[model samples]
Target: MLDARLKEQLRQHLDKISQPVELVATLDAGQKSRDLHALLQEIAELSERVTLRTDGDEARTPSFAIRRPGEETGVIFAGIPLGHEFTSLVLALLQVGGHPPRVSDAQAQRIRALDEDLHFETYYSLSCQNCPDVVQALNLMAVLNPRVRHVAIDGALFQEEVSAREVMSVPAVFLNGEPFDQGRMTLDQILARVDSASTARETERLNAMSAFDVLVVGGGPAGAAAAIYAARKGVRTGLAAERLGGQVLDTQGIENLISVSHTLGPKLAADLEAHVRQYDVDLMDLQRAVALVPAQDASGLHEVRFESGACLRSKSVILATGARWREMGVPGEREYRGHGVAYCPHCDGPLFKGKRVAVIGGGNSGVEAAIDLAGMAAQVTLVEFMNELRADAVLQEKLRALPNVQVIRHAQTTRVEGDGSRVTGLTYKDRDTDAVHTLSLDGIFVQIGLVPNTEWLQGGAVELSGRGEIVTNAHGMTTVPGVFAAGDVTTVPYKQIVIAMGEGARAALGAFDHLIRR
Candidate 1:
């Protein structure tokens, strides 16, 4: 038992302190744990000025009201509260210690009135700066609403969870156990979505239309190529895309694309769009194809339906949708993207000149970016989740030779750390030793693999390979008559932009042949 005088002294000392102090205790079975708890309780009782709470088995605390003595508010966190976790604890304490961060009056009201419980799980890699703003927005929401529980898992730290969730992109936000948003989203946009989700009617439906000579689905490289070719060939082409430029728009440069030595993705896409405009192709920007109806007309035309209640009739169809980048799927990754996180080194690397940066993955793209950025950035850290880099030996030699480059093998990105505005560093865990370490950097580049954009066409008329690529014959003819596929979407064995364009040109010719034969 502690003496009354000692207990009183502890209480007096606690009352004098304004800031919150988090007590982090590691779980150990052999140690005298009961004594620690007893001391904590004694301190809590003697000092009416302090609040003491225990982390439960689940490492989470239930939402409860907390009022601190001599303070206007109180904050609570149920965790070990070490390393990066310590920062979160301090922020919570500050908020509860009568200096809560201010939000817009309207945002505060929206948060206060929210009665529903919202759980947000954001998957991210530390290398992606674009992820942080979304994470900040969600974190702000969590701060505003007690009903909102937000947990950021470093995708690299929790690979199994990431794979299970099928998260293939950084800044992927899951709301109420389902993916709600991906990439950077504004706070107002998120709030609007939450509001809409609460008040919107479920049965709301739009009118449908059916009828085109060519229905080009997707808006990426292949799709755009097909649209341009088909429209130029005098076909009534209707091109639908969720976003113009597809995956290529997110890319930084087109060095590998023939004829374009070092053009930006947006610029390349703009040129392609200009080419498409020269013809009479009907381009549907920000439109998604929800379904494909088989050929209903006697002339073998296919009916393609869009989510916007718009439809087009076409005798021939081309699937040109490209692929998507695979994600690191770590927590705090989605929330911190764009703020301090990033993916495309070519696009954002120059912005971080003479600054520290890290590249995740060991493929050709990853190695290439590291080598390229080594000349510009102050430091380049290359992390390969695998035991060795899969890049070509020449590139590997180049990366190894770079003085500024440091390679971390058998490591995976776990989390990204930053202010609400920009990325500052990243965390990683060793796959073999399970040792976790944080590396300070200004940027992160994800060079993971890509998944083909074929999920929408599953079980459709188009024949797909085991890897989800569209199966095409030598002439680019799909299994369905009058339908052709090209670019990376087809099983062409090569994913080069030149190959895709060549395939697109071939598909256009094949479509013409089908039209004439019919």
Candidate 2:
């Protein structure tokens, strides 16, 4: 049964509906279905604009939808909109009843200008806060454009579709059967990608390009250096990357670039891009390498195909594919990722100002993150699984010097606790004593390790480490004759901007060596 007081509040919200909406509920005669039906009946009675209709069809049982009077299509509600997802139903009603969104005028214009017929199929979980952002953004786009349609699928209700799409997280948006986004994103970011992917991320047949001397597969410091080194020899060099900055964009400040006292990630990214443009490197930005086809013809040109169906051939491929942050793999971690549990301290740290937070891991990065968070959050708790902190002694001392910081060693994070909307705290257990404790905090930052982006390189038969990092030798040479890897993506020890840049130079020189001899 609905809470009496809470039901009154929802009833008042439903009373203000501007248009007639049909709550077409299809529920079985089962006990659980009966409870939902009774709730819907009670909800409908409170609002004159809403009408309830129940269908006891066995196949349609447990499925329902909200349809406007003049609309042929409506938002489907496969699962019960309880708990956090109750707000989704509330917003859906408001938007369908002709309420204007709070989007900027510029964004509205961009959305309205989308004249092509598009359908967005977004999969979401009930507890995920980030999922609502994506769902609302796409719904707003559909509301603004007549040519757009949206179907929000609850992952729990549509298990078959989720499995078929290989969806591992919430807010997995699919446009035209292609995965548009795998995680949380802002509307502006979504629009920007749409602009970039208008001609890219396509699956149509691509015209093969002529052969190139060097092909750099990443766009980080390493890949940029590889391109510069290859082009310095006056050879035809090409670079393909999904993003210009690789993982550098997530970095807030760069103090170790040498000669540069202080610079931001975007600034360094722009500089690297401008530097690459000064040369004759074939820059294929926003293009992902999906597969690497072995040389088929006598031209000795290996092929690198992109998700956009565009294929480029090169005599040599230098893989500087970067890495992504390793996850905590705890319950509620993925669901409340953007909501309160974050991996990027620089990106999401500001949101926790004046709040209490926790940082996982005791390495150099983790200690630095704790120090960073101590400035923003009222108090910072640094948790490490090891008995002793792994960070340098100086860094550990610096972190301990903070008044608002606490260090907890030999602690293992057990679960992320939340109120179904946002994270509220984190629970951990002592490794030695097996005693559990919960810290009441607003956010948790996981700063453990990094996993290389070598999944795409698997198709090319590139040798990889047990951790999935591309394995390379001293000269950055892979097992394949014309293949090489560098940067955090490789099995190189101590990943740093300087180390990556040097590796990229070596890989290019190796490729140059392979070419001059051939």
Candidate 3:
């Protein structure tokens, strides 16, 4: 199952197992089952503390459970967890074997103290980069709390279950057979969802925080750079964001970042967070800013309020809330977001394997998505509003070479059609002939562009552009005296990650200058 290099790495990782762990598999005579059996056998050979058995009674064939001998199983995998989930498999083994997880003591205690009998099942795809985080988080929770159990099912391998459950997205989590979440979620987010009182505890903690010298209102590349720069200047820095990694977390490949030839989005986001942590910055993840209140005088602190009613005061503020995926806004698109309409091609592409799908947009993202989907999807229709594709020449060439792909230029997506359960087709109109057409598809991927997350600042103190981006000066200072802006949320010409980081650094410096002048 595993190559020599992977087997050696697995052996080294499994060597850290401090307690005995058993792999009890229940598999049939199918090829997938045999493959899983061979994989399990190979895994059991990697470490002395690990053993394999075939006496389990799991209903799902080609599935296995990882647990201690004579103990109730807490972790299960319904398919071969290779690809992006290989790390998840390794972590599950280690955690179930009594090795400590890489979480804070309080987090670990919270997980262990959960008294509810929670059973989590996550339907994931092997190629999805976002699925591993959710899978690993649930797996860790299961390992920590005996009452909690998790089953990670590969949606592609279990098509009947995927179809029966109406799961068209990756990392779709169900709690005790009911829908819980539908996207990438961290351990803290999951805990908050399950533990209702966790939010109040967090709110109190946040409300008690002292005023900061520089407050960054986002956690993307821009916010991270600003926080790091401000903290390095020996100022009290605090960063609060809806999601720390922001849009970058949804990104797949990033080869254009300077000094780095190639890197993955999650890896780069982790590195950014780690770098910011090297400073004395207060990191507040998953906090969304609802309002920004500017100071009345030079001595007064600017206040930023969150959805939890927690307010944080700062001498200077940097707005870098970043952006989100631009939706099609057509009818039925919202109704079938998870059912069929997906924005992330890499995350949700596998669920539509051998099914017809459409890519809306003609930019690099759309072309790339079409190219990626052409390999798995039975038929891919690329719809473009422009007469010609705007993607790079190389990308356009590759997209045109795909046999199963059909390019539709000068077409506007008018509406998304679904059968209430899932997407069945789409409605579009030709710009030249004004003729309406429909496409039969199992999924639709919208990759037009991004919309700045500046709606919260609409009636705020800062000046905004026509497109809703915050207006900023050359020094990254906003219309407000002590407040600055940067990155995708601001009036920046480009929305690249490297440019965002540079703008964030500049905004941090500008805020520092304002503070010293005051």
Candidate 4:
């Protein structure tokens, strides 16, 4: 089932198995089952320590389990683990076959300490770039803790289960048969949700840290650049962020980055983190800053507080909290977020295959989404609040060539329509005629724009614009002395990745200058 290049790569990866591994499949006479069996057979042939069997009794057909020789339970795949999840399958094999994981010793110990019996099931689509992180994280937890069991299910393959569960989004996770979360999450985020004591422990650890020369408050491209530049100055630097990748993790394609021909968002985020790690910066992930307290004097240290009640102090701070996807504020939008309303087209598009959907925007993102969805969705309706589309001419031309797309301009989305479990349609009003209309659809993709992550800074020490963005000077220094801001959170004109990096470097240098001349 795998090609020559893939087979060679699989062989090399499987060679790391230090213990015997068994693949047990519960399959039927279907073509998918046959293909899965062939794939397993080929995988088994790659290493002497790997073997395949057909004795699995899982309730789902075409499902398989990767386990040790004598173990009764391990990581399971309810469908073909190809595409984005292929790496998840490989990691499951290596972890189950006595290969050590790359997690920290503390993290491994915490996973082992989870004594309760927990079962997790994650629903994913093959085209989703964000599902692998969640799948691999749960698999690693299962391998580390025997009581933790996880299964990655393909939502496209089992439509019945998806319909029954009302799963309208990719990377939907369930714990103990109840909905847990329905978006991209890191391993630390998952642990923080499951383990109640994790927050207290982390807060205590962070509170004990000493003051830093430079502390960055985000982990997107801007925050990463600031930390790297500050650490390279031979000063103590610390970076705390909700996640290392930030909003970039939700992006799909990124071709405008100068010097790099083409790359994915996750790959670029990883490279940024790796490059930052090459320095002496203290990196902390999954940390959400809730409040910023500026110093009263130049010699006093500024304090940044977290939602977990943890606080870290620094001589000079760089604010690069970045931004998040803006949501349509219509009724039923929040009630059916995962049930039908989605903000990411790349992550949740495949779930609406062969179904009618609507794209709520007219910019480049919306036009590009319409073009991409025309291939899988039965029909795509592009709704715009303006009189005309603002996408590039090339993208508009491409969108016009799609046969199944319908564009409606000067239409404002009023309300989302759902049948309690899933979306059935939507309501919009025509701007020019003030006429109301509704269209039947299975999903709604919102690609409007971004809102800065500066709600915590409101009514605080820093000066903010009317739109809530941080106000900064030419040197990237904010109204508060020794506190600088950059990227989408500030009064920046553009929100490109390259612009964010340059602003971060400028802010870092500004902080250094402030420290020396004080």
How close is every model to the real structure, measured as TM-score?
A: 0.55, 0.64, 0.99, 0.98
lDDT by residue (1-518, candidate 3, tens digit) is 89999999999998899999999999888999999999999999999999999988887888999999999758999999999999999999998898888999989989988998999999999989899999999999988888999999999999999999999998899999999998999999999898878899999999999999999999999999999899999999999998888888888899999999999888888888889888899999879899999999889999999997789999999999999999989899999999999999999999999999999999999999999999999999999999999999999988878899999999999999999899999999999999999999999999999999988888867888898999999889998899999899988897999999999999999999998988
Candidate 1 Cα deviation (angstroms), residue 407: 0.4
Instruction: Point to the candidate with the largest TM-score.
Output: 3
Candidate 2 weakest lDDT stretch, 10 residues:
200-209
lDDT of 2 at 313: 80
Give each model's whole-structure lDDT: 0.67, 0.78, 0.93, 0.93
Off by over 4 Å in 3: none
Q: How many clashing pairs per prediction, in order?
A: 36, 0, 0, 0
Regions of candidate 2 where Cα sits further than 4 Å from its true position: 1-197, 200-206, 296-299
RMSD in Å for all candidates: 16.3, 13.1, 0.8, 1.1
Worst 10-residue lDDT window for candidate 3 reads 454-463
Output the lDDT of residue 19, model 2: 79
**Cα displacement (Å) at residue 284, model 4:** 2.0
List model 1 lDDT by residue over 207-254, tens digit each: 222446777777777777787777777867777776666676666557
Name the better of 1 and 2 by lDDT: 2
- Of the two candidates 2 and 3, the one with more favorable lDDT, higher being better, is 3
Model 1 earns a TM-score of 0.55
